[model samples]
Target chain A: MVSVVPSLWGYAIAGYVMTAGAIGLYVVALHARARRARDRAAAIAGRRRTSTPP
Target chain B: MVSSLERVAGRITAPRGERILGWATLVAMAASAVMSLVVSPPDAQQGNAARLLYIHVPSAWLAYLSFAVVFVASIAYLATRRTRWDRLAAASAEVGVLFTALAIALGSLWGKPVWGTWWTWDPRITTTTILLLIYVGYLAVRRLSDSPARRARWAAVVGVVGFLDVPVSYLSVTWWRGLHQGTTIRLLGESTIAPIMQVALMTGVFAFTLLFLYLVTVRLRLGRLEDRAVAEALSPRLGQSAEALLEQEASARG
Candidate 1:
């Protein structure tokens, strides 16, 4: 009979989960950073755009 | 004529060279995983534990390679005052830090099966832990400094000086009769392991290296973009100053 105990597969599952989680975190970080930088740039350029009003 | 050396050197340092690095890295990582997992036969003695070598060795090599770049690039920046070199050093350090952490984790995991332990204060491991700490501090220094010139200057000096620990970390095994094995890549040439495994590991190392290059380039570009934003924001003041100087010259001539 095949054992369905979690201990047997736990490490493998954990390893896979960690890999997925780390990659996901990295992706999220990249996107968040890019978005923040974009917003910051937009704000900077927006102020410059409005203040000069040429 | 573009000498081969010059071409190779240019490719390594060029900003756009990262594109090549990105493709190479992906290819290497895929090939290595396949080679190590499917192609290479498991060791009779060590069995599955040997499998860990694929990720472990490459990450370790990356640690050395990253610090080496920091050492070399930092010196070049200090000598030339070019922000570009400093940026490369910074990028390499960040990538190196990632791999170093991976190596430590993989090492501990592998050790449990082979050495019956999860952690050890072995000299090599301790040295590596310290090396990781030093680089982390290097990154902190970069974050703490706000002025571009001062940041580069301080970071470059730290990168160059901090490199002294790299050799010590590498030699720790050789220096002490430690449980951790000495650097393994040197054995690549004469290793008894099958050629397929060799291909896998070499592919992985190259891939990781390329990946590092791509990442560094992107990060540096981001830094450059920020600088450009600041400069463009202040361009009006620069223009006004230049116009005032021109007006003063015109009045003096009259």
Candidate 2:
């Protein structure tokens, strides 16, 4: 069997996986930080409300 | 404001002598690249193809070394729970990944002519590829999680476990049938390569390592800046001018 098609496919897929993997990882990292920031903000607000004297 | 910023650049972190050394290394690395790529003898077997060995081998060495730093730093972060260690560990990982990619690609270039194939599952090549994947996953997991400490912990575990793969990759050809050439082990006077070759190879190694260090330092600085920017952007703090703007922007979000 010719190695041509499979080799090309391997290179193609590797290229995609490399890019998608990097971008997907970066986007996920950003969203995670955003979610964390939001959660942190909410927690601080909650703490403020509870701490405020009547 | 722009003039003020230009003045601020004069007061940046690095001391004068250290800055000079850094610049010296840049000059030295260029000189060594010439020595290795131009002055060094072509291998009787691979000719100029072997010239790539200078770049490929040192890069491979530094990648392993850098990741080893990440692994240790990650473990330290996990044990101490320090965010600085987390930053350093993350920085090393990104740099290690980039260098490792370079090594693998350069190796393939050498492999095409020497081995008659670009890759083989022979122990070294396979294990090295595995090492690359492990780091890729380390970076992936890091990217997937938001908490700096959490990402550091998970990546630490992966990095430590990843260490097992490195030596195996190093010894793979020695241990089994492989596409990689075994080290040219020799005894007594035969132990040394020709002086020119040794000079070329050693200079190449040092140059590449310097280049790698420069790259990693820059990457680490960028990562720290990015981390600081993101942290400041999200918080309501206003200690700095940037933070003040960030707070105002956050209010607009409200």
Candidate 3:
């Protein structure tokens, strides 16, 4: 008679996947936010430059 | 000494330095994944389910580290009223919340198999949940005041007070009966884990720490840029161009 033990690999895999996925999403969001802020600052500066008299 | 320290900080926070840190974090994370998933052996008792320990422990540890930084930064902000201290506290708290949530989620995943339940009102779990809520409230408090100084002051106070939960959460398992296990990696005494497992766990912690540093640096840079944009937008002059304003500001600093 063979004793059967349940395979527990799925839980481990799920945990790792969730950790990586959440961190990856956060990194992407941070990059997007930084890009938006940088662009806003640059655009404001450019507008000011073009509108002002030399 | 202060000038030298500032110079060191300037180099580390520079764009090039940030890029270097990012690449290094990527490499460290890759190595950690391999160590965690491939190199480490399965537990004799818990079997493959123990693998979750790698990520779970590191996420939890990083959460603790992040909040500790917030606690110190908040105190500094209250004492000195420095904007940079407030920025550091806010950045650290945001990252701490992310790791705290991740830790709880991963803990649930691990517990489902080992403890035979997905959710429980275990002492540790309860305290940790409350810890998360406190920081969430701290983040929410940042938006309450319109004045930046007022917001920072309020947030700093919350940051300092909310950190009291961290210790309670950590000690909950020992303080009361619970389904959760006690500390595995003991600082003073011998650890219960095997040598190979310890190596894998340490690798995970190192990689996660690097990732935490990288994220906070980027967040701090974003905070600076956002503040500058707001300041520029609010203080526009009729004749002066933004470039002229920037140049004048730079010369003034010089």
Candidate 4:
């Protein structure tokens, strides 16, 4: 008679997937935030340059 | 001394340097995943369920590292009253929170299979949850004041005080009888983990540390840019000259 060991691959896979997904999402969010900040800085700088007399 | 140190930091944190660091982080992460999933064999007892240890351990370790950084930076900010230190503390705290949450989630996933439950009131788990709440509160405190200096002061106080939970969470397993296992990679004595497993775990840790550094660098840059934008917006109303504002911004960026 063969003794069956329960497969835990599902839990392992879920853990790995969740870890990767969360990190990837954070990377995307950081990029979005940096882009927004860069754009805002540029917009403000442009306004200042335009308003300042040469 | 500070100016010189800031100059060095400014050079190292430049875009080109960041790109190199980013590529190195990606490579390290790939190697870590390969080692963790393929190279290392599964545990005799937990079998495949043990695989979660790679990411889970690193996430927890990185969370500890992040909070430690926040603690030191907060102290420096309070002592020197530097915005640079405050920004560093803020960035570290945010990343720490991410890793703390990741650790908890991954721990839950691991527990469900091995311990036959998704959640428990184990000392380590309970203390870790409290640790997470403390940092979350610290972040919330940052938004309480409109004045940057005031916000930093309040956040610094919380950052310093809240770090006391880190040691408590770390030693909770030994201090109390709990479902959580004791430390695996003992520094003073032989590690309980197999050699190959240790290698895989260390690789995961190194990769996560690199990722942490990259994230903090990017976040710091974002914080500087956001501050600059705010300064620019407020400059006209406050009668601050553009040259003076630019000088202040450059100093802060360092």
Winning candidate number (TM-score): 4
lDDT of 1 by residue, B1-254 (tens): 32574467557646567566656766776776677667876665566457677767777888899999999889977776665566678878987888788788878877776788989999988989989999999999998865566777788889988899988988888899889976555654666556777777787677666666666666655554555555545555533332233333333433
Pitting candidate 2 against candidate 4, the one with the higher lDDT is: 4
DockQ for all models, in order? Answer: 0.20, 0.04, 0.74, 0.74
Pairs in clash, predicted candidate 2: none
Relative to the unseen true structure, what is the C-alpha lDDT of residue A44 in candidate 2, on a scale of 0 to 100?
54
Instruction: Give the per-residue Cα lDDT of candidate 1 at B165.
Output: 90
* Candidate 3 lDDT over residue span B141-180, tens digit each: 9989766777888999999999999999999988999989
Candidate 3 residue B143 C-alpha distance from true site, Å: 1.5
lDDT of 2: 0.64
Per-residue C-alpha lDDT of model 2 across residues A8-35, encoded as one tens digit per residue: 2233234334433543464356446545
**Tens digit per residue, CA lDDT, model 2, B186-247:** 43446336668777767867866665555454444455455555655455543444324433
Candidate 4 lDDT, B1-254, residue by residue in tens: 86897787687579987788889999999999999889998777787789899999999999999999999999988787777888889999999999999999999999988899999999999999999999999999999987677788899999999999999999999999999999999989999999999999999999999999898888888888777777877786545653356445444643
Give the per-residue lDDT of model 3 (tens digit) for A1-54: 542555689999999899989999999999899899989988877887787788
Instruction: Using DockQ, rank the candidates from best to worst.
Output: 4, 3, 1, 2
Arrange candidates by lDDT, highest first: which order? Answer: 4, 3, 1, 2
Give the 10-residue window scoring lowest on summed lDDT in candidate 2 chain B.
Answer: B242-251
Which docking band does candidate 4 fall into?
Answer: medium
